[model samples]
Target chain A: MDFLTVIQLLDSTVRLATPLLLACLAGLFSERAGIFDIGLEGKMLAAAFFSAAVAALTGSVWIGLLAGIGASVALSLLHGLASITFRGNQLISGVAINFLAAGLTVLIAQDWFSQGGRTPSLMGGARFEPITLPFADALADVPVVGPVYAELISGHSVLVYLAFLTVPVTWWVLFRTRFGLRLRAVGENPAAVDTAGVSVIGLRYAAVVICGVLCGIAGAYLSTALQAGFVKDMSAGRGFIALAALIFAKWRPWHALYATLLFGLFGALETRQDVITAVIGIKVQGQVLGALPYVMTVIILAGFVGKAIPPRAGGEPYVKER
Target chain B: MDVVPKWAEVILVPLISLMLAAILSALVILAIGEDPVAAVNLMITGALGSTYGWGYTLYYATNFLFTGLAVSVAFHAGLFNIGGEGQAMLGGLGVALACLLVPWPHWTIALLAATVAAGLFGAAWAAIPAFLQARRGSHIVITTIMFNFIAAAVLNYVLVNLMRPAGSMDPATARFPEAVHLPTLHDILGVVGIEFSKSAPANVTFLIAILACVLVWLLLWRTWLGYEIRSYGKSESAAKYAGISPFAITMIAMLISGGLAGMMAINNVMGEAERLVLNAVEGAGFIGIAVALMGRNHPFGVFLAAILFGFLYQGGAELALWTSIPRELIVVIQALIILFTGALDNMVRMPLERLFLMIRRGNA
Candidate 1:
């Protein structure tokens, strides 16, 4: 392969990996705080659904993105109320919330929009326009890597930049900050954190909200940036993939980046199945390709790489006995 | 006002949680641009509108009933076996293959073979996670969910590409023979000149579901193996302390759960479809979570909870038809049931204990 093709392929892979990268970080934060946020799917779906709806309504992409984040944050609050405040089982509540989101989206979409859930496509606000880096055009004049630098490396959404920035930001926050210490402590021993008089509830709540915001962006990216207009069940188990990434990364932010990128590659393959098939002359159907990532996740999780030992108290809610 | 005693706590908490959930559902309806009261009324009327309505509800109900039992069996063994989707899918596929392959005149053999196929396939599907957990100490939830995806994909590919009947263009499998079909109990009811609607496929699947419930109860409470399984489910360490092999018990528990889930295919393919045809397995396996929870892992309770879900499903469909309300109210309702069942379990248990304590005090 030419150097140009390699750079171009690599560039496209980055744009594709952004959403998974963001969502995986969200999972990393929540799980590290010992909250197994299974409702990531619900949060993502709700955000995607709301963002698409609001964007289509107002014809403003920013408003839609904000709405998506708000919806996901609200879902996080619900998770906090049930699992944290009330000491409910995180997994069950998360799963329940996901089902509610799935059902509610379909119900509301049918009742309001009536297009079998493909909301009216927005011309402007419905999507994020790809951005070209300032120096990339000039850099593209370089031999071999020139076209690759301009097209693959440069043309991407703002979130693509944010996704890369988030890795170091997350690492610094989790390791450097006092709040990060508290969060990590809580994951290890909430009772001890409670003993130290740092409010476990407050820290966990903040972690959950942050997780929600990440999921919201992930959702918005899936709909507006990746493919415009909300598709029914559009998260398409990406949240679960994020969860798998978190496990694979051992709840570390930087490790999660690589894990998510791997998953993103799987997803890109799944989406580009026709291309893969055409190039290889393989006669695999669309559905088989679609199921590939899930298959990989299972094989990986089933002790192929290693056992997924979650945060010590992950999924166990803390209730103060006064 | 009287002080709420312990024994009544269990029942009261669930009652209150259910009411709260209902109110929340109403809010949800309002939020979705529908009249909650009218929508709910429609749900009731639609589910039980006529004998025909009752049939469809029962047919759907039987799916939950078997799925519920599948979940409940694992609950008894103290493992969250979430592979019901795959297990049930394989079950349906197994039944379809048997019905297609077994060319026989006898209705009994055809039905038996098909059901047996479902049970065995379900067992295999469940065994994947069970073996992983029992032998490798792998997490059941992840393995099962993965298995579900694989099962769904494989089943769809087979249905669309390989096993699908030649003449049908649709993504479905070969049609089952008429003889293997589950006979409707409504037909039997009509023998006494009792009238019911013709559209209803209210078949012997309901009875089969009920019988499975009874068998589960017997298997759990009556048999020593059931006792051992329950003990194992409660705690691996405790069960081991009591000399039970958690490995063997987990496998057995998972097999029964998967097997019963497979039996639920009777409702979907043979009982309802009149032949073994393919449609993607709906989220009934996941619904098994809510069913198992509402039933609180009890056989009779699971059976009753399934019927309740059936009621909600039928009513939700009806509401969708009558009003502008979407039919997913039932899905929300089921989700709420799961939420409430989990959240309010302690409250319910506490009230029951208090009630029992007060009753004891009064008796003394």
Candidate 2:
């Protein structure tokens, strides 16, 4: 492809990667504090449904985004309560939340909207709009660099930028902030953190809540930014993909961005396999090519990966001996 | 014995959760301007009344039993295996291929080969996670969940590309030749002139599932291997001290569990549909977790829990026909059941047994 085309792909690649990156970071924060947080998918699904519904109803994308976040966080908190406080099975609880969200969303969508999923299409104001900064517009007139600035870096939803920005912010909070240290300490060794005069329960709860908030933004971005509105199972295993990104990134915030972007690249490749096949002159069913990302991901995770050490008591419930 | 009421702990939480979920579901219906009472009542009448619905529900319950057994076995070993879906898919593929492609002189032999193939594939799929967990200390939960997605995606790819038959939105294989479909009990129902009006899929698979349940119970309670598994599950460190290899036992337990799931696929494919099909067993494998949990990891309990889910599966949709709501509400209820069963551990049988023993001794 020409420079302009390559630049275009680069910009779109980042935009596509943002949702997965946001989600992976969301998972990273919670899991780093030693919670499995399996409900990320459910949270996303819930947010997607709510955001779509509210966006279409009130005709305000911003309000819809807030509503979506609220819905996801509520479900996330429900999962947190069951998994963290009740010390329930993290995997099962997460799966349950997902199931509930899936069923409830569909049921409600059908009830109110009367569509077999595929929420009513959004209008101009009800949808998240891409913004090209004034500088981006000016830079678009330059030669090769113009195409790069115009196509790749500009005219994307604002969330895309915010998602990238969160990486540095996350690193700061997780490594430098006291709350981050306490959260990390709880995951590594609740006993020591407890002895250090921090209430491990309180710290972990805060961490989980933070996870819910990030998951909310990720979900809102999914419905409003990534796609126009929610469709049934629109999350389409992205939550699990984000989990994969978490492991791939080793739960580091900055690394998560790269890991998620890599997955997104694979995703883009899979989607653009038609273009790939045209260029290469190969023949294969589109579905097989599409399945490549998941297959390759599993292979990478299962085979070459060295080891993933979960937080010392990540899935265990803390029962104070005293 | 301590004065704690027997069966209270074993039963209360699940019962409460079931009632609460049902009530909440009813409220949802009410909010949606639907009559919950009439809808549920129609579902009950339809499921239990006609022979066909009864048969379909029983067939589904059998699926639940196998999947639930698979999950429960791992749970008893202190392993949470979310790979039942993948394992079951592999098992379904195995049975379908065996029944559809294998050349067998006799139908009975063909069925046997298909069932074995299904069981073997299921075991193999499960063995991947088991082996990883045993050898590398990998987290089975995440690995299994990840594989579940891969399995579905791969299965879809294979079915649509390689195995799809002509003129079908459903990516299913050629129907298994007549030799494979299990004989329905409706034949007997007719012989006695006690017509099972509307015919059901009541066949020998139910008997096989029960037999498997009995065998699982025997193995769990009466065998040295079972003892080792239980001990290992209760405390891996202690199990190691007692000379059992956690890796070996875990692999064996998970394989067996997965094999049982495979057996469920046999009933679903060879015994019923008689073809390798996409969505053949549906999400029964995943639903099995709820079944196994509700049964509190007991053979008999699983049987009943499977029936409950079976009823929901049949009724959840049937109610939809009579109401505007889709039958998938059953899945919602199923999700609620799984959530409650997982969160409240005391409903499980073994712990209840221990609590009972403690209570009895304290009273004495």
Candidate 3:
């Protein structure tokens, strides 16, 4: 492929991968802290709808973003209440949250907007506008680096940069920070953390909340930036795909970025099937191409690619006495 | 002697949880500026009052019965097989193929052949995940979920490329021959001199679903294979000690689950739609998870749960048709029921256990 074509593919990969990256990071934090969250999809859906609804109403993307985060966090707290407080099955709680979000978003949206279960199309300040970096225009004429700098790196919604930046920040938090240490320890052995004078429930709840925040950003980015507004089931299977990506990355932040990017590339190819068909000179079914990420995930999980061992204490709700 | 009665454990807990969910759902309806009482009345009338409503409810319930049984069987083997959606999709393909490839003389012959094909197809889809989980140490939930999506893509490809009728704009297979079209409830009931809704989609597959439930009950409780599966589920190490292989149990359980899930296609593809259409599985596969949970992984419980969900679906459709309540609200209600009955069980159980303890202490 030519340089510009490659850059364009990379650009599309970035756009598609942003949501998966954010959700993957969200799952990373939650799962690394020993919580198995299958509800990332549901949380994102809730955030997307709330964000879009608020953005349409107030015509301010910021307020909508906040509302989205708040809505997602509320669901996270609900998960915490059931899984942590009530000692319920984490997976079941996650499934319930997903179902709740899926249904509630459309129900409330239709009740409020009456636009057939969708919010009004967002525009102007209500939607996220791409930011061009300072050197983007000036560097546009430069041969090899210009388009890569201007087209691939500079022009993206602000949330895209934030998502990419979160990988490093997550790495720092997970390794360098005391809270991260405690979080990891709690996941590996809650009893050790408890004996060392840290609260297991508190740390887990914190992890889940952080997860909710990241998922919120991802969801808001979808409705406000990726698309003009929220539609029912707009998150599609992205949350589940993010979960697959998380497993593919073996629940690490950096690996999550690569996995999501690879998956996003698959998705990008799916959207641009005609271009790919012309380039490859073959008949390629879009559905089969779309199925690549999921198929790859299965192959990876089956230990063909590499072993994926979850956190030692993941999925089990911690009991204080036990 | 156990403090908790078997009957109470089976029935009481779910009843209380369902009641709590209903109350909460009513509050949500009230919040939406609608009359919760009227909504409840409408739901009952719409789902149960008329033969027409009953027909749709039973039809939906038939689909749930298959998928719910699928989930329950896997659960009994300590596996969370979430790929029922995908399995059912493949089963639809099997049904389509069976009806299309051979010119059966009658619907009975077609149903028989289609059942085997659908079961084999669903089992084949699930077998991959089961194999991964059993031999390769993969998580069944994740693999099965991914398979669901893959199943959709495969079904789409087949429908578009292979099954679509010539010159047709729709991405669906040509309708099955008239001889292969299964008898609807109206046709069967009328033969027995009982009037039924002519347009209702409930058909002979509903009987098959009930029979499957009965067979599942016997298999789980009476058969040696079922015993082995349950023992393995209870403790893998213990089962190993008892000479039960985890691999065998997992495969058997998932195959049965997938087969049950696949059988749902007989109702949808052959009975209702009469064609293999894209996304015909819809969210029935996911709903199976909720049904399994609500049913407590019991065959009888699954039957009741399926009917309840079928009611919600048919009733919800009526609500959307007649009132301002959106169709998605039904999903919210279903989710709430799952939340309360499945996730928040301990919320109710802990308090109930304590109360029971207090009563027993007083008696002592």
Q: Give the winner by TM-score.
A: 3
Q: Model 2 in CAPRI terms: which quality?
A: medium
Calculate DockQ per candidate and list them: 0.59, 0.54, 0.86
Worst 10 residues of 3 chain B by lDDT: B1-10
Candidate closest to the true structure, highest DockQ: 3
Please, what are the lDDT tens digits per residue for candidate 2 over residues A58-149? Answer: 99988998898898778777777777777777778888888888888888888889888568988788888999876887888898778777
lDDT of each: 0.80, 0.80, 0.92
Instruction: Give interface RMSD for all predictions.
Output: 2.1, 2.6, 0.9
Clashing pairs in 3: none
Residue B139 lDDT in candidate 1: 68
Going through the candidates in order, state the TM-score of chain A alone for each one: 0.91, 0.93, 0.98
State the lDDT of candidate 1 residue by residue for B51-131, as single tens digits: 877887887788988888898899888787778888999999887787777776876677677778889999988987898
**TM-score for chain A as predicted in candidate 3:** 0.98
TM-score attained by model 2: 0.93
In candidate 3, what are the lDDT values of residues B152-229, reduced to their tens digit? 989888888988999998999988899998899999999999999999999999999999999999999999999998
lDDT of 1 at B25: 91
TM-score to native of every candidate shown:
0.92, 0.93, 0.98
Candidate 1 vs candidate 2: the TM-score winner is: 2
Among all windows of 10 consecutive residues in model 2 chain B, the one with the lowest summed lDDT is B343-352
Alpha-carbon runs more than 4 Å astray in model 2: A278-303, B1-6, B165-170, B191-193, B197-202, B344-364
